[model samples]
Target chain A: MARNSSLVFEGRQTQLKPLFPEDVTQEYVSWLKDPGVNEFLEARFKKHTLATQRAYVRGFDQKTKFLWGIFDKKTKKHIGVITLYDIHPMHKYANYGYLIGNKKYWGTGAAQEAIALVFDFAFLKLRIRSISTGAYAPNVASVFNYKKMGLSYQGTFKERLLYKGAFVDQVWYGITRDEWLSRRKKLAF
Target chain B: MSTEERIKSIMADSLEVDRTLIKDNASIYTIAQWDSLQHLRLVMALQEEFGMRFGDREIPDLVSFAAIQEAITKKMKSHGKE
Candidate 1:
């Protein structure tokens, strides 16, 4: 398979490439429908169709939001998706999210590398001051990975998300440009 | 405890399983309780126990008991311990 030449950023283990409409396959739709994959995601609350995914991909714009497919460099397979959304040029900040839809890649640090690449883009190229995100408190992997990536805890909304029959806290996290710069040298590329 | 035993104990504690179930070769696939979330907790526990921070590149290779043992050994050696 040919490498997606439109890769916007490269990391140690994964690359971030533009998510084109054609990249929305049945497999992608299936991932969204997979309860195991979507349980921690808001996407689990809704059904996803290929048509809807295609339209979502087609709606990507760099101004307000940027979506990218997380591709494994060694296997050259698209494993997940990452996005820097709610970008505000005036505020110089954004909120981000990521999903490693492939279970095989979970806990493998692929998400961490993808997150580092996004931070590089947000802080270096786009000159974003602060990048914020949130994770359900019960999602241990998301919480651990976000903290490991140097995102400081901002606050939490009590019983913000109804998950698995109980309401869970939604914890917010963010990292500023200065924070990223100070820690970038130690982080794996 | 030896490095292997230490790793097994950490894994068992993190996954809330009996320590006897975590053999030298036990891995994420082999252990029912060692799911993805537990894996991160295992990593965090290992880090706290060893006082060593694992790089992102090193985290993926630590799925199995032997791998964790080897990684901890290497890290300990680098820190002039063991």
Candidate 2:
């Protein structure tokens, strides 16, 4: 529907942009369905036929879940995905998620750039009061990434997710708008 | 005895690993326990030991021991400790 405008969040050496339908169909779904890639993800979509994939992308755009395709400005490659889901307009808050889907880009701080962009949107544009997210307690990498974005661990949700025949505890974390503004000392220009 | 050795001690302690494993250029990603939370702890430890604080521009860049050393060196030089 193209309801939203193309917004770019620039970092020291990277940039973030909202994902268009074209990019979603071309790359996003394939990346998501990769077994090794989707290991940490809870829901697995079956059989992405041409029609199904197209419909999936369109459906995603229709939701309030804003998805951003992360790119490395230097290489101009689509490295990962990040999203602000479960948006609460009245409360000015959302639940967020991200993944550096590309193995080559892991440990490169590109995810951090994507997160900084989300922070920019939440605090600078949307005026969101808080953003919350949860990670499987065993997913150390995701937990580490969240904390790096200044999110404080709230608590553990015991057996919150059943994945791969086992119930996984979730560690919930969040950062308030006021806390973000106060902690943010660098205005990356 | 040397600046490098002192830095290694700090790294070993902060990372909660063997001193011998902490090379001169070891980074947070290279160590298991040196994740983001530990990263913050390391920064605070350095501040306490050196009696200094880092500005926003430097925190993200302080991922490696070499980077930390450079930051500390710069702070020291600014204070005329070098």
List ranges where model 2 is wrong by over 4 Å.
A3-6, A25-27, A60-63, A186-189, B1-82
Query: Model 1, DockQ value?
Result: 0.10
Q: After superposition, how far is residue A181 of candidate 1 from its true place, in Å?
A: 1.3
Scored by lDDT, model 2 comes in at 0.71
Docking class for model 2 is: incorrect
Query: Among all windows of ten consecutive residues in candidate 1 chain A, which has the lowest summed lDDT?
Result: A1-10
Candidate 2 lDDT, tens digit per residue, A26-108? 46567677887777785363665555655655555535667777888888888887888788879888888887777777655
Per-prediction DockQ, in order? 0.10, 0.08
Distance from true location, Cα of A104 in model 2, Å:
0.6
Candidate 1 lDDT score at position B48 = 95
What are the lDDT figures for the candidates, one per model?
0.81, 0.71
Q: Report the number of the highest-DockQ candidate.
A: 1
Tens digits of per-residue lDDT, candidate 1, A1-189, equal: 233454478877887897888888888898999989998888888879988898888777644678899999988898999998888879998999999989888866788788888888889878999999988877766665665676777898999999889887888889999998887766645
